[model samples]
Target: MSFLHSLGLFATLGLIYGCSTTSSLTSAQQRDAYLQQFIGQTSQSIQARLDLNSIGYQQVLAPVANDQTLTYTVIRPVTIPVPIAQNPADIDAGNIPIPVTPRAQSYDVNLQCKIIFRLENNMAKSVYYTGRTC
Candidate 1:
């Protein structure tokens, strides 16, 4: 009985640990506050503040002719696999061996961070970001 009780305690502790380790995305408010620091800063300065390898920038034509905006976008992809269940009834009826095979389906979860920097006189006049982060 002591062994069984110890097993149950371990199982409960395992569940608690597993639940605490689950990953989640950063809150929108937090992301907005972090991106707000880029306003009035040059692209070079912004690059200095973040990991350059993870950052991508593009030049886009603004709504007004001859105006341009620099946009920076970061993307992280998480791969998750579809779960499969075995048909116990079919296996028992056919006395078949369990098949060894790879999973048939999986999906890529894309977490994106996009920041638009409006430029005036080669300096960032305004900054805004949109998208999710995990």
Candidate 2:
């Protein structure tokens, strides 16, 4: 009986761990799909479509007159639950009560999208898009 219980517990833990890891991969895949549409497009076109001003820009590498690389980072806010105070006396003694509800917290996840454009004679000759979310 003890062996069976231990096996079940391990199985449950394994499933939980697997799920947590898979979610990040899924997020990365989704971001990759969205960035694919920018391939073969000029930097100006991509900026216009994505509204670079609203998201804010990160780095601009323009080593020469014709070649330019633009990096844009987008941040999404996420809310998560926090532990509530267990001691009733502490809550009463403090001015603020222990929040039972979830509080807004900022996660460290950020998506960085880079657009590299090579121009020849003031015309875009090649364009590349790469992004990662973590």
Candidate 3:
């Protein structure tokens, strides 16, 4: 009975330990490695090019990202809802009603992976994403 209890406790502790390390890049070396891997990624798993007017990642996490290692991620594709003309374009010419504004549909840009970064201090330091503009 005593031996079984000890084994169970050990297993529980081991599971907890494993979970803690999942996102805990605990050292600068680890952060650097992670940033390198992060930047090397060719694409994002959820990339939707912002409208030239639309805001990029910076506006979202300003001051904090400037000082410490920052990481942002999305699990799936970032979909932009393009209001497509759901109405049929090929309606008969003679009886066609006046065309209203075209409705848009959603299309997604699939990014191959997630984006992460490591910053040194309060500035948009270039830890990654040099080849491509964020």
Best by TM-score: 1
TM-scores, all candidates, are 0.48, 0.42, 0.24
Q: Could you tell me which 10 consecutive residues in candidate 3 have the lowest summed lDDT?
A: 45-54
Model 3, position 24, has a per-residue lDDT of 46
Candidate 2: clashing pairs of residues: none
For candidate 3, lDDT tens digit of each residue in 1-134?
A: 47567656655564455444333445325534444543422223112221211222222322223244444532223443432232355465444655444332333443332244554433224454321223
lDDT of each: 0.53, 0.47, 0.37
lDDT of 1 at 123: 67
| lDDT by residue for model 1 (1-100), tens | 5756765665566545543442333434455556567778766676567442333223232222124566666555544443344557878899785664
Q: Per-residue lDDT of 14-101 in model 2, one digit per residue for the tens? A: 5555446544766656644555665666657665675433333333333223345544534333322222225567667885654443
Residue 108's lDDT within candidate 2 is 29
* Global fold similarity of model 3 (TM-score): 0.24
Q: In order, how many clashes per candidate?
A: 0, 0, 11
CA lDDT of 39 in candidate 3? Answer: 40
